[model samples]
Target: MSDSEPRMIEILRILSQQEKPIGSKLIADELNEKGFNLGERAVRYHMQILDEKGYTERKGYSGRVITELGRDKLEKGLIYDQVDFIYSKFEEMIYLTDFNYITQRGNVVVNTSTIYNEESINILKSIIESGLSVSPYVNINEDKSKGKIEVTTLCGTTIDGILLNEGIPAQPQYGGLLRIEDYKPIRFEELISYKKTSLTPLDAFSSPNRTSVMDVVTSGDGLIPANFRLIPGIGREKTIEIIKKLDKIGIGGIIAISDEGKDILGITVPKGMVGISIVGGITPFRAIQEQGQEIDIKIAEEIRDFNTLSPITSTIKYGLKPVEHTPQPKISFLLSKSWNLIQQVNFDIEKRKGDIISNVSYLKKEDLDKTLGIMEETYNSNPKYINPYYKIVNHPSDDNMVGIATICSLSIDGLLINNGIMSNPKYGGLLELTEPPLFIELISYNGSTVDPHKIFIAKNMTSISGNFGPNKILASFKEIPYIAREYAVDLLDTLDKIGFSIYKIGKPREVTYNAKAENYNFGVVAGSGLNSIAAVRERGVDIHVKAIEQLMPFENMDRL
Candidate 1:
């Protein structure tokens, strides 16, 4: 039968389904309901043609009914649709079962490049529908001249397990799907440059290679942290899954993902919320690593579970091990500058202070000595606070010095002196509760009024349990005063005449990130590395630096 005969056969099927003879109008209505959309006049014309062709016969006063010939034609049409569907399914099966290149023993060689285009994505969808785990990245060389795709599985046996289950004749050889080919190696620096130019937030976030060390220290042994919901995962679907889980638990907080998929830092749970931090960044991990600090097994475990809520209780249950932390050279310089600025500014302000914060008792030599002594004891005891990873130096000479120095600088600059930790003895009493006086508190105090902004303290500060003064607001590490990029640069410049570049600051510029699938094509431009970029922009410095800033504070902020 001709291709057009199939349309006529569809009409015959409608006639046979009816209990009695059907008119052309009724036949047309049925065809419309079935998506044929033929007009009654046209159906009537077709019925005459069917009669002449001997597939249909006219009944007494009734329009037409399917004869034996028509019934045969209708059956054939149904089989045709079924065969067409089976053909597509077979195509998918062939793609999944057969490999373009296989190992010597016929082990499947899965080319990651096969999954990037439209045709390949359809095959990938079929594979996923069979409940296979798919990784977001394929390690292919950046150079397009060599047509090779790198295959990476979450773990070994992922491919073999799937292939064996499908009864395919394939065996796992090496960890990767492909054997070594004549491919050019892409250097780390080149990759970074390529990513800087091309990678988007979504691409970076969804990339299988994107690995983040989540710090649950922010949220410990509590309900799922609110911040966890805000960070985006590999793609929209995965991100939606995270949002659904967080919403199911019934907590709300901001979680912004970075363009590079590196940093997911923000306040997840609000202040006073007793939840672990699901929001995290790897900057600190990288920072410490850059300084030759190896990630302890415990730290690595924490990183693995950071995105999920499983190990949160354990995080709170056990105290962290003491890891030696020395800031990077530039960071060290900034820390020294932060300390010197405080001392220099404080000395200059102490001499010309006519009238300062009302009822505020500035640190006397004895008080400074007493504060430093307390800090030294705390630092020696708690290694967590001893080597400030990303914040101010906790050394005896630098403890409480950055705050004091910032206050002095601001005071000398003629900014209004606010109620800082050093400005009031009660604040000192409040800070004294924390094991290490590594904490900084900044309260707003203009001539006759107090600023409505709550006093800023770290989320983990021991002083928050009704011990600190009333109206104290505990904030996350990112909310620290000097952690702001502009403020940090100012602080850095104040202490050291020689300037340093801030790598982790600024928003991510334009870039491309793609993840394509059937009925799905995600391309992020301005959206690339948003979470990572945001982490840098929002959190200011890197993790170690921000970690230090968490216990750090601002002085004379109103003046500055």
Candidate 2:
């Protein structure tokens, strides 16, 4: 046989016989026992080869860890010359969202702004020095009472979220109590708290170090709330196995690797339906450690299985995407926005008989093979449905990415599949929702006989949930009421001429909203839904929106 047996296979066979991956010197001594006369160089060569093949994936540049293939080959005396092994690559770091880079390392700081001062900078430095991770952030909001927070980023800074590199309770949600928003040049005051991890890739060859607080926290039952799926051991195949289990369960996933006796091929997983989660925040966060950075990977207490429904439930929260949301007759400012998002069913088809759907016909693997065999006859035989999503890029000038429009798609069950945005770690699944072009209706109310000279004006557009009251509909233009109304009418006419179709007639819905000229403004509203018209339940998000606007000339809006 060609001495081409995989270096990993040979190393593993040696370890299986000897029970571990050993140093080159020891491996040489052992090979001598087998009458192989393999010198130190030979052993080193094998190690190098194994590492290159990723059978022994390395971390922090030099520390190598064995993979699933290595473990299997070790146990089975995998033939070096011809045996084939499967290889897997770790997911990108941005996708590693389940845990962040914080722990009991006291220096952890969560904030709405940037880190400032010597002490704060020290914490950030410690994070990098700790070797595993250190963090500085912008726009991270937290509300401890209800367990919710919104994280935001202004400059598109990509940093890992809170990490618990130690003992953790099962399925913890770390974000409920804290929220982060993103903005420019962070000021330390906005910083909230963050969970700090103990391990750093810096100076790994040196003796492992620990922080005083980190020791206690990692060793104690410190709360680290993040929803995660755990696999018991390390290896490429086993790593994939656990992920497959989670996939079958239906919830979207992110992955984290637990270091064990052998491997380095750790993968990262982020929260939500896809890896592309992004937030444009108004605040940033602060760092935790001041100095002497060290990663604390101490396991806390053992977690007990609390929720028995792990097997019964398949998703994070039981939410489903509708193939289409019924359109409400858009009359108010808020309703109009929702109407714009509402898509109508255009494909005409009758329900297929359950008889055909039920088919009850058995399909053998052979049948599939035959069907595919026929398609295989063509040059491009593979069905197009299985094709992966192609990513799209855009110019940096887009605001909230509103400058351009992207195609959004969805699965039959309503989960977002893809749309116009690039489907990377931060933009996955979100493809289903798009902010359609802003459309407005202007009615020139030249004061009726019963009422004063009240001119029905328009302006200040916002999200679909914004309202129809004065504050939201652009009252500033009242001084230029004619200009505003004409502008709106012109825009509508332009849209109509450009081929936009109205699915429903208009109606006037009296919406109570704050007003400038008067304490309140009541107005008529008209809008359309996706395929038809429908209404959404009114909530706080409504008044806030109708009350303000952005992008075009409008008022700044938020809930009162």
Using TM-score, give the best candidate's number: 2
Give the runs in model 2 whose Cα sits over 4 Å from its true position. 1-119, 122-171, 174-403, 411-560
Q: What's the lDDT for all of these models?
A: 0.27, 0.23
Residue-by-residue lDDT tens digits, candidate 2, 219-255: 3211111111222332334434433443343222231
Assess the local accuracy of residue 557 in candidate 1 as a C-alpha lDDT between 0 and 100. Answer: 20
Looking at model 2, which ten-residue stretch has the lowest summed lDDT?
423-432
| Segments in model 1 whose C-alpha atoms lie over 4 Å from true places | 1-136, 142-415, 418-560
Weakest ten-residue segment in model 1 by summed lDDT:
185-194
The alpha-carbon deviation from the true structure for residue 104 of candidate 1, after best TM-score superposition, in angstroms, is 31
Per-residue alpha-carbon lDDT of model 1 for 1-560, expressed as tens digits? 24445467678877876778889888888878656878988888788889998899999787788899877655433332322323232223333332211221222212222112233333322222221222221222233454322222121112322233334322211010101011211101100100111111111122122221122223211111111221122233443343344333321121222332332121122222211112112222221222333221111010011111111111111112221122212112122223333333222222332321111112334344443343334324432212111112333453433222211112212111122212110011011222212112221111101111111111122221122221212211111122233443343333222111111112122111111111111111110001111122222221211111111232322210
